[model samples]
Target: EPEVTQTPSHQVTQMGQEVILRCVPISNHLYFYWYRQILGQKVEFLVSFYNNEISEKSEIFDDQFSVERPDGSNFTLKIRSTKLEDSAMYFCASTGLRGLRNSPLHFGNGTRLTVT
Candidate 1:
């Protein structure tokens, strides 16, 4: 089956360094989204992108955050200025437009971002 893949399963950075988390979404899928979970918090939606523009974004996607489809298979999230609060497991998900009763989103294992 097709699956999303994330790189650098774990990353460590200083409080203000920039970091780019990379993901390879499942091919043939259209909708793309990013969500994060702080160590013990609930998963929070960051943003969703489609057709070359943002379809939806939550308050969590502040000015410091940005998403780009740098290439056909690559979806990346860039944090211009990392903060301690940014430490979390970033998950990349993709889904096809079908099954409203089960809008299941396939998620990558996730990239754990650690800021000190």
Candidate 2:
């Protein structure tokens, strides 16, 4: 199985600040996604990207969030003017073309964002 990796395992930012969370998904994966888990809350899906565009996004991925595939190896999630409620463990995940059943989502350890 391939691996997904995330950077800056932890981040601290004040409210209304911008922070870009970074990840490097498996090399050949065709789908990518971002999900988050607030303290004591269930993991929530944020966005999914494919073929260079956003394939789907949840309402929580409002104007405050953006995602990008700046290069072949990196996928990123950017939170703008983050609010205290944005504090969560942001995860980056990817899967192969066969879809979820054949290619179960591979997730990174996650970047813990603390918005104070």
Candidate 3:
């Protein structure tokens, strides 16, 4: 089965450095999303992309963050200036179908972002 794959399961960076987290979503999937989970918090939606544009984004997706489909399979999230609170688990998810209430998204193990 096709699956979402994320690189560098754990990343550590200084509080104000830049970091690019990468993911390879399922080949046939049409919708992609980024979510983050603070150590003991709920999974918060960051952004959703489809048809090469952002479909929806949350307040968490601020000026310092951006996403791109640099290639056919690679989806990337770049954080221009990381903050200490940015430390969390970033998850990449994809759905094969669009807007289907029953379409379950498959998620990667997530990249643990650590800021110091």
Candidate 4:
């Protein structure tokens, strides 16, 4: 089974800078999602995408955050002017033919962003 792959397992950046996290989701999956977990906290949903458009997003996904599928094989998350609180483990996940609730979701190891 092909799994999601994320780049740069760890990233360190200063506050008020822009960052882009990358992911290559399973080629055959129909749904993709972005989630983030602050250190020692529960995972929070960021955004969901399907058919090349955003399907849902959370309040945390404010103007500073955006998600896109620039190509069929890649999905990305951009955080503009990142703040200290933005530091977290960002994860990329995808599910098979069936929707999320009905199918198993596969997740990448995650990109740990550290904004100082």
Over 4 Å off in model 3, which ranges? none
For candidate 3, give the lDDT of residue 16. Answer: 92
- Per-residue alpha-carbon lDDT of candidate 4 for residues 1-116, written as tens digits (9 for 90 to 100): 67899998999999999999999999889899999999999999999998989999999989999888998899999999999999999999998676568897799999999999
The number of clashing residue pairs in each candidate reads 0, 0, 0, 0
Residue 113 of candidate 4: its Cα lDDT?
Answer: 100
Which regions in candidate 4 have their CA more than 4 angstroms from the true location?
none
Q: What are the per-residue Cα lDDT tens digits for candidate 2 across 17-81?
A: 99999999999888999999999999999999999999999999999999999999999999989
Which residue pairs show backbone clashes in model 1?
none
Flag clash pairs in model 4: none
Candidate 2 stretches greater than 4 Å from native: none
Candidate 3 lDDT by residue in tens digits, 31-98: 89999999999999999998888899999999999999988998999999999999999999999666
lDDT of 1 by residue, 33-88 (tens): 99999998999999998887789999999999999998899999999999999999
Evaluate all candidate structures by whole-model CA lDDT and list the values in order: 0.93, 0.95, 0.94, 0.93
Where's the lowest-lDDT run of ten residues in candidate 3?
A: 94-103
